[model samples]
Target: MKRLRRVDRTQFQKLTYPHLEFLYNMALKYCGNTYDAEDVLQETMYRAYRNFHQLRDEAKCKPWLFAILRTTFLREQRSLKKRPLLDDGSGYLKHVVDQDRKSLGALLEEKMDKANVQQLLEMMPEKHKSPLILYYMEDMTYREIADLLDIPIGTVMSRLARAKKQMKKNLLKKLGMHKKKRNFSIISVFLPGGGL
Candidate 1:
């Protein structure tokens, strides 16, 4: 690996290091384990360090690093010849809880707590889950997701839409059954203007 220049090291440590947690979380979501995610993160940093000189725009560092990380993880998965890891239910549930805790309070978290959502999401093919995770978890725009995934923006939007619909259907089925047993009414409110 080429040694990072003082300025490059400073910039990476200052700007990129802060995002390590975000990267790790995304990696964990992708790989479905802390160990694999850490491996991917470490490999990503190593690749980033080696190829830092090739990065043309400093402002694109975040997305660029993520792309590299995704590529590396995919390559690693292929090498291992293991089935693509799915959400283990617990990990994704913890992630959802953590996200809810961060953005919404515990009360809202309780209301939003649907363990089946994670399992349903995991059941989705990577084509759907990847874009959904990138768009929702990484807060990436469709265009950004396209760039990272090396696909067109329309594809990302379409896959996201389908993924969301599938998730909703699965959640509804699971919750409906649960409510039926408990003798509770399940009401679904669709916004007048929302499509998909």
Candidate 2:
């Protein structure tokens, strides 16, 4: 019994120790926060430790770990008692905008002057943005993205279509094309002795 436990421990350490940081970063990108990603990583590692025997091939370790992490995150999100609204309270807004400006300078120079589309991308919902990012940013094939997200290929296509539409709307509004209407109520006060 002790020998089996020792072998399991060795395998877990050998499989996960080197890839922990990579897995954490990937999880963080999906989870969109440091603390949540950290928790997800920990839970994923724990599960991997318990289910180490289920891994069929050691060569498929990276994808397997990522799948576990992704599943763990999704499960946590579903089980939340009250999901909190996404906000830019952690200075991530500034950081993301700055990085976008620096990295996309060529696009800015060619297309327009100083357009921060990346920050706008950050404001988009995870469901919409995830497929788009995985498709365009990461250069993954639709099939690969579908596999990674555990969704049908058609669903991935639909989500990408809807996501592009939303992105267009958001960009237009941000550029001041579709201004939001403001409602104002005016009250009149009548003074003694009306004008003669």
Candidate 3:
């Protein structure tokens, strides 16, 4: 491992250390559990520390760190040869939704609580869920999400659109089966007109 100099250490701490909580939350979402998330976080931090000097623009630290985290998680996933389990159903989306309140519209925010939104996110496929989580939860731009996920910008936008559509369908289906379906007029929340 490379030893960080005094200035390097200070720079790293200032630029990267503050994002620890963001890393943890994202790792938890990606790994879908605390233990694996911690492992991913540990590896990510270590890698970041070693590579801190290579970062050209300190302003891009978040996306750089996210790329490391995402890459490490994928490597770990491949080595383990098992898909991550969505074991925690207890309001993960709540934290994500709350993290970026400005991105959502007022009406959508009013209609959707943390739990249902979390359920909507959790139920989406990993391909779609990954981008949605980055875009909405982390409030990353489409280009940043594309860089981190290593997909094209067009693909990122397409996936997000598809994810929202899928979420609306799932939410509507779930609500329609319930007695409170009549009271819930929240399908537009996931639709394009409300917000992205």
**Best candidate, lDDT:** 3
Q: Write the per-residue lDDT of candidate 3 for residues 1-196, one digit (tens) a residue.
A: 3454877888889999889999998997686446788999999999999988789998899999999999999999796655444445873422222323344333344456777777777789999989877876677899999999999999998998898777766777767743443544445444434332
Error of 1 at 194 (Å): 30
Per-candidate Cα lDDT values, in order, are 0.67, 0.68, 0.75
Q: What lDDT, from 0 to 1, does candidate 3 have?
A: 0.75
Candidate 1 — which residues are off by over 4 angstroms?
A: 1-4, 82-196
TM for candidate 1 is 0.42
Q: Summarize candidate 2's per-residue lDDT along 90-193 as a digit string, tens digits.
A: 84522222222122223222233444656657768999989877765566778999999999999998997776666655655666755644311100001011
Better of 1 and 2 by lDDT: 2
Off by over 4 Å in 2: 81-196
Candidate 2 structure, TM-score to reference? 0.43
